[model samples]
Target: MNSGIGPMVKSQSSIPLYAIILILCLIAIIGGYFLSKKYPLNTNELKAIFEKEDGESNDITEPSGDIGNSYAAIDSSGVESGEHGHYATPLSQVNKHNIDEVFHVAGELVDYDTADQVCKQYGARLASYDELLHAYQHGAEWCNYGWSQNQTAYYPTQKKTWERLQYGKTELEKTMCGVPGLNGGRFKKNMKFNVNCFGKRPDKPDTDFVHPKLPKKPTKEQSKEELKHFDDLVVIPYNRKRWSRKDYEPHPV
Candidate 1:
C-alpha cells in the first residue's frame, strides 16, 4: 500500500472539441456580418452583369398580324409598345412632345365608344386621320384596323401588299397611296376595332377656354355654293387626275 498511485483525474484546463468548434463558428458568423455591412449587394447590377454575360436582351422585335396581340398588353407601369417597332422602353419615359408617336392601345377589338374610353384611360384621344397618315409616312405601321377621328377606321401599311389589298381599294381606280380608308364599307359606331391613341395626357382640365357659338344651318343654295367651294379647295385639288369619274359626281353621305 505504500506505492499508492490512485485513479487519475481528468485535466480541467483543456477545452472540449464541441466547445472549440462552436467558438470558431461564432467568429466566422461575426466576420461574415461585418463584411456584408461593408460591401452591400446590388441585385439590379448583378442582373445586368449576368444578362450581359448570357447575351440576353430586353428588346422585343416587332410582331405582325394577330400574332402580335401581346404588343397591346400594358405593363404595371401603364405602357405598351414603344415608338415604331421596338418594345424596349416604356412610352411614359419617352418625350411627350413628340407628336409623331402613335400608340396602339387595344389588343382586342372594341366598339368606337369603348375605343374612345380606352384611349382616354391612357390619357390620350383617338388619332386624327391626318395624324395617322403622318405617322404612316414616318414609319408607323399596324395591320389591325384602328378607330380614328371622324368615325373612320384605317390601318397603315408600308406597301400595297395582297393581304392589305384584301381590305379593298380606297379609291375607284385602286392606285391611291398612303393610309387608305378601310374599304370594308362605311364604319359603324358599334363595329369593333383597335384604337390608335395620340397626344400626351393633359395635366389638368382645360377651364380657360369658352365654347364657341354654333353656326346657323345654310340654305340649299348656300349649301350648294359651299359645296362648290369645298370641291374647288379640297376635292378637285385632291382628286385632280387621281380620282375616277364616279368620284367627280357628289354622292349622298
Candidate 2:
C-alpha cells in the first residue's frame, strides 16, 4: 500500500528519538555548569563587592587631625585600677566592690564606699584575707568546697597546691602584694577585728596618721618598721560584715 511514505514514517520515528537524546544532553550540560558555580565567588570579587559596599557606609566618623593631638588622659597613672586578687584567684569571683556578708564569701567587700560600690553592681566584692584564701582554695579545687579538709590547701603556700582545699597564701602573697587586708599594719580603735579569723595580727597601722587638728601617734624612729610597711599598703579584699559578740558563738571581740 504505502510505498516511499512508509519508509519516511519509520525515519521520522528515529528523528524523534535523536531529538530527545539531544535535549537530555543539553540539560546535563546546563546542570553541570550550575553545579560547578555553587561555591561563592573568588576573593577578588568578594573584596571588590566589600569595597563597593563599604564606600557607601557613613555613620560615626573617626577623630580627625589636630583634635587627636590635643587629647590626653586625665586619670593619674600608677594607681590600682581593677579589683585585687590572688594568683590562684579565679576571675569569676573578683568584684571591686562591697562584701556584704558577715562570714566573708570569697567575693564579699569589706567597705561600702569603694570596693562595694563596684561589686554591688554585679552582687560581688572583695574578700577578706581569709575569705580570699578560701576563694583561692575553691579555685584549686575547681570551686568545689565539699570534702575539703586538707591543711596544706587551707593555708597559704605557693609551694604547694593541688586538687584539694588548700588555702595557703604562697600564690596569694604574690598577687595580693600591698592590698589593704593582705598587707595591713594592724587594727585601730574603730577597726572591727576578728581575733578568731585574723589570729592576733593587728589590722591597722601601729602608728596613727596626723590630722591637721589632731595629734600624731608615733614617729618613724618610734615604730619605723611599721611606717615603712605602711608604704607597702596595697588594696586587700575584705568582707563587709560588722561582727559583734552576739554574731559569734563565743563572742568575736
The lDDT leader among the candidates is 1
State the TM-score for model 2.
Answer: 0.17
For model 2, how does the per-residue alpha-carbon lDDT over 24-123 read when each residue is reduced to its tens digit? 9999999888986996458876677787798854344421111000011011121212122122122354333222221122323232223333333334
For model 1, the local distance difference test gives 0.53
**In each prediction, how many residue pairs overlap at the backbone (N, C-alpha, C within less than 3 A)?**
0, 36
- Model 2, CA-based lDDT: 0.30
TM-score, one value per model? 0.35, 0.17
Instruction: Report the C-alpha lDDT of model 1 over 1-253, residue by residue, as the tens digit.
Output: 5569877798788798999999999999999999889998898888888987899984554411221222222121111223222221243543343232456554468887777886766557888877776665544454457787878877665443323333342452133223343322249999998777775522212222221121234568876765633344544443655466655766599
What is the TM-score (0 to 1) of candidate 1? 0.35
State how far residue 130 of model 1 sits from its true place (Å). 0.6
